[model samples]
Every structure is written in structure tokens, then in C-alpha cells.
Target: MRRTPHCRRAHQEHLGKGTPLSVIICDIDHFKQVNDRHGHLSGDRVIQEVAGLIARQLRAGDPAIRWGGEEFLVVVQASSGVAMGLAERLRSAVEHFHDPEVGQVTLSLGVAEILSGESIEQLLGRADGALYRAKRSGRNCTISAAGN
Candidate 1:
């Protein structure tokens, strides 16, 4: 939640300097079932591992926040292409994770770049809508905002 404001401020500042700002909303694929079948401890382990993987992949100064249960928000100061690439890397890392407890974990990501006159809420909403699309498309994939 706090990260949202920081992301907005960063986006606002970078927008003035002609730098693009992108946000990624990542959700664990079928996370509720993981918890139900493997227990909450296993779910916690998966969450920790996922968070670590995301943090490791981020560039210096980029923010990766645990947005909610099985969901994360990553804010990057880069073009939409760069941000999408970063998300793909994270998704691949999660896919190939060799977890002894939860086995293979996967992520669905939504990437959205800040438009010239977009608000933070609007930006997040777009990314979230993209996330819904990714989930509906069978998960473990990445989808950028419309026309992006």
C-alpha cells in the first residue's frame, strides 16, 4: 500500500524527465489450492521464496512489494519493453524453482506503463485488469496493458 505512493511519486518524477515508469502485478498461480493442499506453512515458504526471487531480479532501487496474499507489486523505472522483460525473467525463475515443499510454483504477471496523464490508481487498475486476463488465459504467463 505504501509502495503505491512511492511508485506514484517515482512515476511523477520520472515522467517529467522523459523516463518511462512501469508497474507489474504478479499473482501466484492457484495459490489458494496450494495453501489448502499443502498447508499454510508450505504456502508461507512459497511466498518467501517467490518474494526472494522477485527481489533478486529487480535492478538496484527498484521496489518489489508484497501486495497481498499471493500477489506482489513491482515498480520499475524503465520502458514497457524493459519491464516486460524483467517480468518474464521473474516468471521463469518462479517456474523453474526447485522447492522441496511446494514443488514447482508459477506466477502470472501484468505489466503496465504509466501513460502521460494517468493516475496511480488508473495505472494499477490497468495492470490488474491485465492480470485478470492472464489468469483467464490459463496462468503462468505475462500480459501487458492494452496497446502496450
Candidate 2:
């Protein structure tokens, strides 16, 4: 919560090691509409609920950060395919998440495996692009980084 840069540093140790690292960027679909309809407090509750769902699904050592607002960033030390599976699982969980006040929520996710010799910015940019594609593709779905 201090800053996004601090969160990103947690994974720096494994970079340049040729490890199978991946990133997933998840965004709440139609989040503005939720805020407008349910009020900011409800929006906060929704963010908390979604964050909890994302946290529960992560394995030990993986990092899930509230990137900002209704968006989350997850770093997984796995292949792109594995990351895709994880993203899909998270999306499904959000789709089924039931809240007495907010009802069901959904997530659109973009996932990418870090390539050797790639910087964090490159990795995140790819993931973000994939996330954008997911949002464009109608949300509540996962998209893997193309050609990576």
C-alpha cells in the first residue's frame, strides 16, 4: 500500500536468472458503473472482496498487489501457460463471487511470462497490453501475451 514500486521490488531478485516468471494484471469490469450505482463505500467493499479472492488463490511466495483502485497485479514464478491457467481461475472466482451488497463481480485479466533479458517494465507493459485486449474482448476473460 505504500507504493507500487515497493511491491515490484519483491520480484527483482529472480529477474535475470532465467526463471519462469510471469505477470497478471486484473481489472474489475465496469468498475465505474459499480461505484456510481453502489457508492464509494460499496466500491471499497467490492475492492476488498476482489482482493481477498485474488489473494486466496495465490500460492506461497507469489505476490498479489492492489496496483490501484480496482486493479491488481500478480507476479507468478511459472510459465506463461501456467500463468494463463491461474488468471482464468482468478477470473472464474471473481465471476462467482457473491456479496450481499454488491452481488457478483467479474475480472478481466492479462497475463504474460517474462522473457530472458527483459526488464520489469517490458514484462508489465506486455501484461498490461494483454489486459487491455481482455477488456476489449468483453471482459471476465484471460488473455495471454501474444507471441510470448
Candidate 1, TM-score vs. the true structure? 0.94
Error of 2 at 133 (Å): 0.4
Candidate 2 lDDT score relative to the true structure: 0.84
**What lDDT score goes with residue 89 in model 2?**
89
TM-scores for all candidates: the values are 0.94, 0.90
lDDT of 1 by residue, 64-125 (tens): 88898889999888888999999999999999997897789899999999887887778888
> Candidate 1, clashing residue pairs?
none
Task: Tell me the tens digit of each residue's lDDT in model 2 across 21-95.
Answer: 788899999999989999999999999999999989998678688787898989887788998899998999899
* Candidate 2 local lDDT, residue 36: 93
Question: Cα lDDT of all candidates, in order?
Answer: 0.89, 0.84
- Model 1 residue runs over 4 Å out of place are 1-3
Q: Alpha carbon lDDT of residue 21, candidate 2?
A: 77
TM-score of 2: 0.90
